[model samples]
Target: MTSGKIGNQASLQSIFDPIIAAPSDRPFVVAQLGQSLDGRIATASGDSRGINGAAALDHLHRLRSNVDAIVVGIGTIIADDPQLTVRRVDGPQPIRVIIDPKGRLPATARCLATGDSKCLVVTSKAEAVPKGAEGLVIKASAPRIEPGDIVEALFKRGLKKILVEGGGTTISHFINAGMIDRIHILVAPLILGSGIPGLSLIPVGSIDEAIWPKTSAHVLDGGDVLFDCDLRHQRRG
Candidate 1:
């Protein structure tokens, strides 16, 4: 892991010692996002092309270069049509995993187009898998697939290091379920005024009931702030 500096002299490793020290039994899930100062991930139109500064973008690419697999929700696939491969960084690209509960991702999606890495489509339905992808049918207990189920499926497939890039809902589910082992969030200076939230979940009655993770803050290349939070899955009682 590269040393991303904190406020003064704290190293990224120092801030993430707990997370780095975690057992390697299963994939170490990391949730990453680039949000606005107002905590909005995208504008009202769902545009999230260039919110992150160059440095943060590079950081994101480096992150992508390291993980064994990358995961995103079906909404992100439909909205961004991302080719979730590592660019602007030197390393092997991670496998792309898409959670499309209904198996609705279009075959023409960019992620399904071209990349050296493999793409795994996770859906609850056993119907047709999108072209250029492998299918893993995980039955849903609710209207949607559960976070724990996704993790289990990936882990059993030997995906030991995972990164989850987002479009809010998927990240919220993982966060609320305490399934996130660590997170890398870049808070930009721009404000969206009105847009989709970075983390949208059920309301919490009190701050005391919140799950507090050990964190380290740092300013990126263009004055954008990066917050690295490591969760032990322990919530305050």
Candidate 2:
């Protein structure tokens, strides 16, 4: 649930109700990103602390609560070392998913180490799965696992709905592959003149060729804006 007067509890929850109700037999993918006015997700040093305020973070937690699993890429693991758990809010811990097709994440990494929650490491490292994680080794190249294959695997694992919380490259992968069902982009107040961008995998010849999702936006607590974009058309196209 991103965008528009999220202050109302009922209204905020309503935003994600449709997404949460997506057909359960298949994988419903929702991608979330918090970026700057200039479109950078993080600075050159990879610091993304508090880009969006507490309210936005709470929203993220709620989204996580609604999903059956959370997916991310190795870049996110390396840069943020995110726990990928619900801490600020009260909810069940959704399964944590990491897309490290090469098995790049170290065994000591937070997402793989503590085992506070179940984690699925989607990799091409077919030989071994780390101690605290399960492996879904796609027969694809390292760092380029097919999103469709990953979705199918997750569905087989009983995870019908997936929330992809990502670093730029990972988001771009799903976007370029046209596997995303919806998008929730949080735009913060600051700007980074040069750094990592939000989505970058698609190439367009003109503004008319740009991929546009049906969207809406609303303000958050700390001068940030949430953009709730429906992208089912992409999935069909």
Top candidate when judged by lDDT against the true structure:
2
Task: For residues 1-237, write the lDDT of model 2, one tens digit per residue.
Answer: 324576755678777886767987678999999999999888878878878888789889888888889999988998888889888777778899998776677777787765367888988876556778888878885448888888888889898888999987887888888888888899999878877788887687777777767778988777788888888753221
Show where candidate 2 strays beyond 4 Å.
Answer: 1-3, 114-116, 141-143, 234-237
lDDT for every model? 0.81, 0.82
Candidate 1 lDDT over 5-24, as tens digits, reads 44332343354454355567
lDDT (Cα) of model 2: 0.82
Measured against the true structure, the TM-scores of the candidates, in listed sequence, are 0.90, 0.92
C-alpha root-mean-square deviation, candidate 1: 3.3
